[model samples]
Target: MEGGGGEQALSADNVRGIVLALISSGFIGGSFIIKKKGLRRAAAASGIGAGVGGHSYLLEPLWWVGMITMIVGEIANFVAYAFAPAVLVTPLGALSIIVSAVLAHFILKERLQALGVLGCVMCITGSMVIVIHAPQEQEIASVKEIWKLATQPSFLLYVALVIVMVSVLMFHFSPLWGQSNVLIYTAICSLMGSLSVMSVKALGTSLKLTFEGTNQLVYPETWFFVLVVSTCVLTQMNYLNKALDTFNTAIVSPIYYVMFTTLTILASIIMFKDWSGQSLGSITSEICGLIVVLSGTILLHVTKDYERIPQSKSIYAPLSPSLTTRLTGELLDHVEDGRASDEEKVLRRQEMF
Candidate 1:
């Protein structure tokens, strides 16, 4: 009877993990597409409106809109992770590439080669397999408990300091922009997202403190954890963004999720001490899932080509005889009609040459 009950519990856990993974994957995939589009629009607006004075009111609105979208995405992500197994949740996030690819096809009109398509398929298959076959019945402690643990003064101070230091480094080094603009943009988006989550938490606490007459407002630990989580997320996102910049979104996104999922699972073991006393079969499944993830990542590099179409040479190259003659004639006519001055003609001629 006990054995049967254990088996049933395991099955239930497996199902939960799979469902969580799927939800996380879909949300993250959608978020990436939205973020990319928003960023592109913002960049264009900044370029067009920021003239010689380099000041534009348009920038504020665009930045805020992007920030809001990012915040919403992160909230969805956190909710999904809270319910699902970290391993399952993390790997499913890789579905962003699939989402990005589809969106890019319809919106950006970016052509996808056969290799890109194959890579996408491999990534999807591997990610699904990893999630579906993940070991079940792992115990997760309540978020409230985690929050309490994080609230300890020593731990709170340490996390707070770490987050501050990392934020400073990110701002000063601007690693993403220097190494890869896409990464920089993604990091900025993630930072905003993390802050948004922290803000939401603060608002909730404030309400509780105000209406319920609780003393939650005085807890520094609450803010400290918020900063820690946000910084950690931002740092991870930087690397993920860099990966996406070079590889097809389909390929890169899945791999990132896989990496994170694996990390989360490992962390769970070390930090939470969950999954203890698991059967050999369950352990094997976890190992096999990791192998599948590795295979998918390998397939991404194997089936992908990074060659870009060489841009056409400019139509307005250095002045040739024909162009020079045409410009000179136009200038001569303008001068003869008194539409321009002699100095203007000379200046125009010099410009053509």
Candidate 2:
């Protein structure tokens, strides 16, 4: 009877994980679209010149809007993690690629060739497979257990830090016109976002602005982890934005979410030891799922033709004022021919000049 009950519990867990994964993926897809729109609106409101500096009072409203949107997205994601297994939820988040592609086609008027659509479908299928088959009831370790795992010497963290620093430096030196500014801005925004998340976690549900104790700011390990994660996320976002400038969202968004989702799964496993008691069969299924997701992403890559859309032509040709003025002078000359005095001709010449 107990064995049957355990089996039933396991099945329930699997169902919950799969559902959460789908929900999380939808949220992630919505987030990319929202972020793109928010950034565009912010840029429009503040004007182009606002990009010249790191800090802009004029951009405050836009930042707040973006921050709020991000916060909402994060909360939704947190809920997903709370209810679903991380392995399931993380892969499901890869659905952002499909979401982004569809949104880009309709909203941005971007073209999605046959290959692009294929890629999107592949990514979706692959990710779904991975999440669906992942182990349903891995052991849930406490914060302390997770922290111990994270504290282990990791060259990856240091490597990530160095890369981030170099990226920041490159951003500083790069000219403004090349869209390098977008990278820096993205990094800053990401950092701000990470801080916002940390604040929410630390402050609990109320999210009160009141600072009741100074000691709350003293968790170095927490801050370090936050910084690393924030920088990585921001860098990814910046790259994704830059890619969008070249590739349509359809091509770029899916690849990104797939990459991030894969990385996050690995990170979760390594940092939290979350898969401590999973069976070999469950692990194999999870791996196969990831492989399927990757296959889909590859299909998307093949479908993209790397062709830029042609610019739309204006319906009416614009009149040049200088050309109009010159034409008017010529007409006046024709009218005054042979009938006008020498003084009149001289005056007309001066006016034309």
Query: Considering every candidate listed, which one attains the maximal lDDT?
Result: 2
Q: Give model 1 RMSD, 1 decimal.
A: 15.6
lDDT of 1 by residue, 224-256 (tens): 555654554444444433433343433333343
As a TM-score, model 1 comes out at 0.50
Candidate 1 runs further than 4 Å off: 1-24, 31-70, 136-224, 230-262, 294-353
Lowest summed lDDT across 10 adjacent residues in model 1 is found at 322-331
lDDT of 2 by residue, 1-353 (tens): 11111222335545654665455445545544454454445444445212222123235554355345434544555544534455565555446456655776687564677877876776676665555445444432333333455466652463355457545644663345334233333333233332222222223211111233323234454455445545544543444334344333334334443444454456456543546566566567677777776666556444443232111111111111100000011101112345544333322221110
Sum up the clashes in candidate 2: 6
**lDDT (CA) for every model shown?**
0.41, 0.42
> How high is each candidate's TM-score?
0.50, 0.49
lDDT of 2: 0.42
RMSD of each: 15.6, 17.1
